[model samples]
Target: MMLYKLRLTFVLIAIGLNIGVQAQDFIPILKKRAYLNNSYQKLLKVTDTLKIAFIGGSITETNKGWRDQTMQWFASKYPNAKFKQINAGLSGTGSSLGVYRIDEHVLNHQPDLVFIEFAVNDYKASKHHILEAFEGMVLKIKKANPKTDICFIYTFSEAMLESYEKGFYPNSIIAMEEIASHYNISSVNFAPDIIQRIKNKTLAVIGPKQHPDSTYFSSDGVHPYENTGHLYYTQTLTKALDKLLNKGKRFNSKKDIYYSAQLEKAKMTHLETQMFNGIKAEIPPPKFSSLIQNIFALNQVEDLLQIQFKGDRIGFMDIIGPSSGTLKIKIDDQEPQYITRFDRFCSYERLHWFIIDGLAPDIQHSISISLAPNRIDKARILGKATDTEDYKKETWRVGKILMVDK
Candidate 1:
């Protein structure tokens, strides 16, 4: 009996050791490639503030998520280096929207190290739009400052697992990776890393903590719980950055031309309503509002507002809500185009880019917008209680205009 008991204990010990070894073998590690080599070196030699920009969807926008943790890691890593974290994340926006707003949201900050994460959000955007927006963003960053270092951080959502299980990266990842490779930009894909751990039976996909479940990592399978999700991101980023700090620049002189087409003509310029008319005219500011600011509200169908700027392409920086309405836009001697800001799934105050591109560059262009005679009483998904109270009768509101120059 004693011998049998001892043998059973020995077998259990062996099984545990084997499982531990398997888990260790599957431990996820990021690539050792260097990113923003010149900018990083400059940070090491200077005492000025090192601004690190985090731009992406909700994951990146969460102030407490990986953004802050990564910044903290940098602070501890470089005790003497001054670091400032710039949060340029807009929730529910993909790279296409990002390209249009990057100038106003991110480039204005002038960061030294920028992390662009849009793998999950870009899933809804077309491949063509993704390429143009992604490439446009990278090129714009380079154009803003050649020494600015950029890294494309690929994050995976729970829905993305199906494709990974089929031995394929998601479409968004595939599209963004192409651009990252062309630019020789450093990229880190954490999907496979997490997937590997799950397959190894060490990580849980869903369950209560008392049992075997890791649903706590991500509550809805897309947006991660700040603590768990952010930890995973920071771990991957800090590990890769630590490795990169010990390495030399990947390129002797980083090549500037990643793609042949510069996409420079796709730039956007923001013009406020004050540019069209003063504070007391055809457009009036909201009596009481919180979501939008410095906007010109129009209620009547005949209320016309015109803006003239020196650029080829122009777009409106406006938000949509339950009270939003349709508008007719005319650009530089062209027929009027009709646009609606209302949708079946519209409720939140989010920036919408209504743009008309492909105009003659270096020429003056005029744009006129007015409320369409027809109104849309959208079916409220969240009920009428959430409608914008002050602008219940307002049809169209112009927040700002964006013009692009070649």
Candidate 2:
């Protein structure tokens, strides 16, 4: 009987892993192989176009880490360089909620490079509150973006090397390698370089020697298995960012401390889903009997719409027509992103407004936004604009669409 219900769900998740809790320690995922074989600083600048950012917690969540093999290794080496990446990881966040949304997710997406994976849940809230919230997210992104570039990833979890020879255990990767050597920043001891590439056997097989098995990541246990961890981030983070891309000035420039670049891996599409996903809000702008119609566009034409639901969740907001795509939530018997954020007040994409994480409060649930099965990233009303802000520019223009259900 399906192998006896998968061996009774693995003996009830191995008796919920032998009932216990509190233990967290041994945080050493640090060592950045002597300043990670480096170079770069002839007036510190390297950008033919790159917006790289990963943040941390839930292992840099986005398509579940190693971000689609660092976007297929920057579209096969800067194919017209415009490789932008953003994950702002947020799943049981640490580093004190990534220093309260590091200025709305890494200084409002103005990244040049940032791959800071928090040392295993900020040493589970200690190790001096993960070095005072990671020196306040690297001194507030170097005092508000000083040519943005900061890398400090020290991700360990194979019970962080069976409590890496404990002492307060590698004090948050030796206080983040002494704050990336007092701020020259750029480091990535990715779990001891994947456990010395799995003890020199050149990587292959790991999981439950302490925890990392989901074939090494994704599905939690701290995220990554994103398509084979992007060849382990193109052989350890693009071979340490190709020895600091087209090098120049003194990096580890002190004997046995200089470098070069060579990387190949990309095709990146990591989409775990939701980070202002689409977009939505409480939507409270009409009243006094409320009814406003500002038809913008909708070429698929199912026109004439209206909706109104209040408080503790309800549904009914359809804009069925002029399909540009992505409306999700047509659940009649399931299979529709299971609509619920008390029933969606968000998911708008391009114009940005994802308030999702909802559903379940039927109100006779028939919520419809229709048409969606990929059209890139859009929420359209048939795009036929003539002026003044569009959100469905001009299609369902009869009595202007509105429905109030309490």
Candidate 3:
């Protein structure tokens, strides 16, 4: 029977090896904490609709990308549960713009979970602005609903791949990590795995033009290809979620109950009573001037928006798009100056804010803006303009007025 025992041992060993390989599928979290307790509880119940919101730049906004795939995976994973997904992704925008838009775009929907991706877009912003803006978003979300879960997602640009290879995140991501740690929020970073794949020659950072194999991340270094790169991103995120929700420690004990009660009390006291009012009363020390709490739509050339305020600076936030036209602005009877709303990147509509600083402070200043009657040279502005005909019917849509106190 020694031969029979030997065969049984080999079978058991093969089974053990298979189990070990399956176990390695999840990327290690190490010390990074992503409880995801609130959403986990909701998924377990499978009773109510779970609303998930994604807010970022073009990466999150792309069709059939990680955002869509993740939503589909969630639906399939929890077939009994109802799910609602909110897409608040805007192209060429960062956290500074995100905080302003969150109230109307995200918080209004009241999502159960929010996935924030802005590392690549916010790369150019100062570390201080990144911190302020990201923290502002967290505070605003928590203030709106304490139970809502938030996850910070960090995606990469080709320029960033070198940094990841050298064993570090870009500066913007570092700032975001600080905010995430401070708030006890979780984050999913796709950089390490993607970088590893690139190193192994399995995944190309650029396209087939650069690499021999057709497998690639993106044509442009910034946005990932919907099929290959986005699939990798979705796989990494879903696997992390599986590990975090299924194997990670959850908050379901007496001690956790007490902790949750205290946390809610603290949030109510500090966020509702103090922080929320502070945000409304005073603008955060801005990189530029702060946005005014109003939106005006200037649809026609005759349409005008005028505001009188005491501040050192003045500006307006507008929806910039292919059809956006120039505006004529007059400050306190001064000669009117023309400003074009369209730019090289205005192929699509996006919320854009500008500031005219160094204005006279302490005294009330009158500023009026009306659509200009001038026809802009699309060929000159856009360089090989695709929609020259559309540019003929230009419209102006302004969002908020920006100002800074003396």
On lDDT, the stronger of 1 and 2 is 1
**Top of the candidates by lDDT:** 3
Give, for candidate 2, the lowest lDDT window spanning 10 residues: 1-10
Q: Give candidate 1 regions above 4 Å deviation.
A: 1-33, 197-214, 250-262, 265-268, 272-293, 308-312, 332-336, 358-366, 380-394
Residues 245-339 of candidate 1 have per-residue lDDT tens digits of 54365532255554433354454553454554443333223421322345666667776778777655667766665567888888888899888
**Which residue pairs clash within candidate 3?**
none
Query: What RMSD value applies to candidate 2?
Result: 21.1
Query: Each model's C-alpha lDDT?
Result: 0.65, 0.43, 0.67
lDDT of 2: 0.43
RMSD of each: 9.6, 21.1, 12.6
> How do all the candidates rank in terms of TM-score, highest first?
1, 3, 2
Residue 260 C-alpha lDDT in model 3? 13
Reference-based TM-score of each model? 0.77, 0.24, 0.71
User: Per-residue lDDT for 1-406 in model 2, tens only?
Assistant: 0011111000011321111111232222222333321212312334444667788765666563575576677568655455667767654446544654555566677776677877766664544445555665666665565556677876655555544423223456656555566556656565544544554555444443234433443333454565554356445666656555554432332222111100001011111112122332223234201211222332342421223233223222223322223445443365666321111212221111122214453444443443333442223222334233333332211112111123
Best by TM-score: 1
